[model samples]
Target: MSTLTFRSVSLRYPPRAARAGVGEKLVLDGIDLQVASHELVAIIGRSGSGKTSLLNLAAGFLEPTAGTITVDGVPIEGPSADRAVVFQDDALYPWLDARDNIALPFKLKGVPLAERRARAEQLLARVGLADAGDRRIWELSGGMRQRVGIARALAAEPRFLLLDEPLGALDALTRTRMQEFLLRIKAESGAGALLITHSIEEALLLGTRIVVLSPNPGRLTAEIEAGFNAEVLNGASVAAVKASPIFKRMHAGLTGLIHASAEEEIAA
Candidate 1:
């Protein structure tokens, strides 16, 4: 059971002398968050809310100015296989085919070709790309490439999955289907996920817990126990859960919460 925890973590860009005369920039402050293997936490807030900053910190791309971040009780000093990130931009190698991209991490660890191929094939199928394993990255569509990116992340078998608006580029219908796909993946892998998204409905649909952050120097403004997928876990259809009254209520409430946060930001 892997867990990621942040204890009063704060991140800031040290005072810069008059680039725009803005001076110091505090991106995030006093963030305390935890994600267990059994839970997926979704963070939503307005643009410039430092949502991506929080994910970058967790991914070990940046160090916190204060407090600490730990994965499975150990300090995260740099990027490790324990945390896998999927950015909005698909970062697949253009020279490689889908299967090769997914198997890259295993290859880095010196796994034999036969084993890596089998593992990559399994992950491709898990991401709904079973037949597209050999297709070159250039041959895939934007959404398909994104799926391969996710498949690559899955192949790492990371304890924590960090997603930054991974589906923000998809059409509405495709986004919905991908949401279902993500839920299935989470069910199967039980890996803790931290998804930073701009969509309230998306967060409500997939997150076990939804967190809202305030703007500028982001801070946790609200946390909601979504549990919207609870019924889905009991064999209820995704469509049924999406159309349920509870989902509608929570959707409206979250929409309001976002608006309230935006107003607060403007007023501050």
Candidate 2:
């Protein structure tokens, strides 16, 4: 069962300003979300909307102030091998080459060098970096580094993949290619993916469901069903599908929701 559930989860940060004389700063409130096997849930919002916070909570990097998150009914106490995270910075070891970086997790697990190398090679090919495996971290481009990061995450063989703006740092063309790569990887891995992104188009294209959050103590503002991800997985032309009427409709509606939420924040 590829199930991840967050029930009424909330996060609050202690007041940092001296003499501010305020209560805790709430970042997330009453969040209820679920991701199932073969599902991609995209989280989108403006800056400071706690998009990354939700991902961090899921990764066990931070504990919520209240509520619970479970994986297949088991409470999440800390990071586990069954869950892997890909950050926006492509957090690879600077000293390691691409192949070694991808295999690092395996090596830590006591996997023989040969077996880890073989698996890393396969993952490299999967991410379109077949020939770049020998390149050191510094030798690759930003997009290439992120590709290696993805390969490394897959090395862990995680059942759930948590991504925080995984493609946000790439150039437009590279980002587009990586989106396709992401879709293919998700299909092949059959893992539940929760991606936090700023680009609404990216969210709509990559997610079977899109969850929008409001600013300042982020809360779920809207939940949209976007099946274009399924279409892309089924070999449908992504560009053509994006241009379809339903896509346009949902995009317009979501944009409106985001704007309304922003306006609400301003008015408050």
Candidate 3:
């Protein structure tokens, strides 16, 4: 059964001078969504389309101005350990090294120091930063820092993961590598994930279900299943997917929808 649900969800930014005469800008409007247990769903939209806001809502960082959001049959009130969020910025503590940063959550929860250290070491290794565990945030590469952030999130062992453009800052090569890492991690972890991203290619490559949102007062514009099987990772057949009719169609359709929506906003 699906563990997350949002019904008639809407969010409004507080009225500012720019929007005061018109109205409070509605960021999200009537978002009705459900993410089943162990399902990886990607939400795609242009900037200001409320993709990050949606993740924030799910993470319980922000409460919806309207409607209900529930996780594990419980209505979400505020941030909880049950849901872990990895933001666009790699928010690792600068002073703490990767291992300590990953262990922070466990430490906060009063887990034994030995246990926290062992789990942190395991997660850092899992994320391919085993030898770099003692490296400070500033010392590591951008991709390595991002991996540390991911490891920290996983250390909590949350039921649901909310990712807000976690790979947005990486270079193209790094982004592709991170994408594969994320796919592999998801496959192995079986943790439900809701990823908010602007990249159509990323969405297509990563999502089981891709959701498109229309900008002004963000509403779901379309939902499409990205028909990628688990084998895509293990098999070394990139050319096949590029040549695939279904993949091409999805790429074109999602790209077109995003552009069209942006154009509509401009014309309005």
Q: How much lDDT does candidate 2 score?
A: 0.90
Clashing residue pairs for model 1: none
Compose the digit string of candidate 1's lDDT tens values, residues 67-186.
Answer: 899987889989887899988988899899999999999998899999999999999988888999889999998788888998898888899889889999888888887887777787
Per-model CA lDDT versus the true structure? 0.88, 0.90, 0.85
| Model 3 regions lying over 4 Å from their true place | 15-23, 234-240, 266-268
Best by TM-score: 2
What is the TM-score (0 to 1) of candidate 1?
0.94
From the highest lDDT down, the ranking of the candidates is: 2, 1, 3
Please provide, for model 2 over 84-144, each residue's C-alpha lDDT reduced to its tens digit, 9 standing for 90 to 100. Answer: 9998999899888999999998998999999999999999999889999899899999889
Q: Which candidate model has the greater lDDT, 1 or 2?
A: 2
Segments in model 2 whose C-alpha atoms lie over 4 Å from true places:
15-23
Residue pairs whose backbone atoms clash in candidate 2: none
* TM-score for each predicted model, relative to the true structure: 0.94, 0.95, 0.92
